[model samples]
Target: MAGDRGAVRRARDWTRDWGRIWGGAWHRGDGTILAALLAAWVLGVSVWPLARLFLEALAPGADGVPLGLMAEVLEARSTGRAFRNTLAASAGSVVIATVLGTVLAFATGLLRLRGRVAMTFLILSPLLIPSQTMALAWIELSGSNSPVLRPLGLAPPPGTTNPIYSGGGIALLMGIEHMPLVFIALRAALATLPADLVEAARIAGAGRLRILTRIILPLALPSALAGAILAFAAAVGNFGVPALLGIPGRFPMLTTLIYQRLNGFGPSVAGQVAVLALILVALALGALGLRALVLSRLSVPLGRGAALRPLDPGRARLPLEAAIWAVLAVIAILPMLALVATALSPALGVALSASTATTANFHEVLANPTIRRAFANSLLLSALAALVCTLVALPFAWLKVSARAPLIRLLDWLVDGPWVVPGTVVALAMILAFLPPLPLVGSLYGTFAILLLAYLARFLPLVLRPVVAGAEALEPAQDEAARIVGAGPLRRILFVLAPALLPAAMAGALILMMTAVNELTLSALLWSSGNETLGVMVFALQYEGNSTAAAATSVLSLLMVLALALALDAMRRWLPPGTLPWRD
Candidate 1:
């Protein structure tokens, strides 16, 4: 029902955008109208699907009660179990993330250490790797078939269930994945910590421990709490970690439950899944509200001043750096080594060596036409997503930061709606919204178009955020100078405005492409038979017991991501501040 309304509304938006932009944007000397139209398009991407999902969830259906369906869903044993599992896993992971992230933040952010930049990037590796790929790496690291661990006799015995399928393993990996959020937030908060305050504490007979307890932790607690809550929210929404681990391990989560129900029963279960999605939304919202309340109460906003100088560890410096590196290697480096070893092995449980290793897995991954097609599809879709997002974000971000267009600015907040929600929820919304036939176009379900649209909606904010910051940083005089010379909207944007924001736009687009290329959760649900993404293929191969091939494919995708990240780092000297997350 709501799908039809959404389709008509989209048609209207298309008409408006085409009629206003190409027909008149060049004729007029102003860009505001063009910006608004683009912003409207961005806004529509979020609204239609979400609206459809809500309507599907709220409709009386066969029953006449409004809230009865929700109650029924909430009361189901599986639903209750999923909620409890989600909270327990999230709670456990948040504790892990807080401890690791806060420790890393202080060690890297406050201490003077050799090779800090490299160590910091290594520490943040979990964020760069996709959740599914990370799950695979950990599985390979811990499973009975692990080449790396089997050599050391540390692996669980064969015929024993792999321990990684347990709830504890899910929490451990998720914690590592989200640790960077807390690290970044706490570091940012610590950046504002006044050196004078620390210096005074030091001068007043305060030791390092006393100063840390009295001064640093107090000021940094609010941001750490905020980051922890963000981590908790993220854990609740995570699908890949639990899907890969939880399903085989028999640990049910809301994300896995939704996927299983929808995948098994199709869109007929969307209403029921929508109820689960609402639970996820509620958990995320509750986290946000808790953060705001905590910040309001506990936050001690301090004046900006000279940052505290890096503390010297003196006699402990070498040991401190070595310990940090060791921990990072165990968490970030060893699992990947295990994954690569598995990829190179001839078969499962085979140890890797120059004499024993074979390239058969790589050959299968690369030479298989279907697998090749999946790779091509992923690359093409990601490139398109990046290109389209970059084009749309330029105009929308300009108006968004300009402060002159209140309406556009108001609608801009909707961008985060699609981004922050669970990937499963967004994919479900896409299914519900486009499964039905439209006025001119037919049903988008099982088509390539839906995947592309989902990528756009999911990633536009990633591109727009940096561009908005770049736009905000621009001097109005530069734009005004061009306008004074009678330059048209297109001319000013192409010639004067775009050049200034190119670095930011490119960085965002690159990151967006990297993210979309190896995405598993959305593609897992949205992919059709011929349109398998790399993520779906790897997941399928692993599920089908082709572990070697899955590892090979995952390695290829991870290499692409790493290569792009390195390229971005190489180019970051020319980009704006905050473009690279790991940069000092």
Candidate 2:
């Protein structure tokens, strides 16, 4: 009887301890609640789905933990060809992008060139345009019945097929699409170049070419390598370019191959296709790892000094400026003009003469119920995602800066997993995780919630990064003062901290909204009937041979992007440096 009483006493003590722990978790000063939310989001949106995909690939048909499926996938002829094609196209595009981007960066960042700001905007316009739209514009510009070419009597022969429907064409367009990444990286590096070093070299009688080759190139090499790796990763994961250009030309990359298999054979082949997704992930990760290694070994530390002054081109400035304009014309203006022409054409394949030009395509798309629904849906999703992500980012950023919890730091790292992983992989994981009825939610597979959840997961990092920057720059004295005045943690955050971080949060939300509105890859797999996004509708119209409608939709989408960019540009005076890409 005494021993039983002792056991009961121990049980009571354990219950009291548990209650204390639970109470601490609910306390406001500690970041326990915020940490828990972040953990839940990371697991539900990223970790769970990725783990399921890996498991499905490795253990198909209940055969537990075997390499047989992976080996078979690797050995398949189709897999081999697609892998090679992906590597080749990625490498080719990286080379092209690096060259073009480096030249543009030097001219705009280092040279005393005319209209540099406008040129920078034009050069980066591809980042605003969707990959599929870029591919479509190129197609319209190149085909035998090309509106731009046909008007000048320079159209290719009738029997000649569009050259853009080939692997080389995919590489070309992908390079153009990703050039901005390299340009931005190199331009940033150039902005940090020390004027003292360049001036000393010039004083030593070094010529322009000598200083450029010996001094500038070496210092910029690390950024160039980093940019090359980014371009390569983007190329490997790109679906729109491969889908629009490669499939028709019989050149399939891993992304497109996965789409084709799952789409054609349904979920029955999911495990098999997941093997392909794994390969893509491996390739992208490998490139990123290489980038890290190279940067670690090759990075040059610069002394603090004034920035390098722009160099004059003397008598050559006019020709160089003309060359820059011509390149921009080919990459930006021509394709846009072709898209406009196509949108104005009476029908597909019609010549864009004065008589054939009309606003019928734009009017028709605007009036269509389906198109209107898609626009509304896209706008709503993008806006909600931006607002929600911004809200969540605030507390998380606070936790990251103020909390010393190991779990908070770990969660911070894990949040980037969804952003870095290919969208195809993310979509596949989402399908695998949510295809069945969720506990209280029922099936989310066909609902708009799935898309919203994916967007939140994919874009949370965008909002988090900027807010963290703002939080890190903040002085902790104010919060401490508020606390000493008897203000609670919640009151301090709401009244003291929120106002300071509002601008950065707003900027991040604007960027997220623009990015998500025309997003393709995530929506490509997640979208269903009556739940179409602008990207899906554009792809569908093009696939159905309604090029005119597709062009009109693309034009409208581009206009929105430009309008947002302009709005941001107008507000750049009040924003911090580096907040707006075009402004920087």
Question: Could you give candidate 1's per-residue lDDT for residues 244-324 as a string of tens digits?
Answer: 999999999999999999889998888899999989988988997898898899998787789888899899899999989
**How well does candidate 2 score on lDDT at residue 16?**
96
Winning candidate number (TM-score): 2
Clash counts per candidate, in order, are 0, 0
Q: Against the true structure, what is each candidate's TM-score?
A: 0.94, 0.94
Residue 490 shift from truth in candidate 1, angstroms: 2.2
Top of the candidates by lDDT: 1
Provide the overall lDDT of each model, using Cα atoms, as 2-decimal numbers: 0.87, 0.86
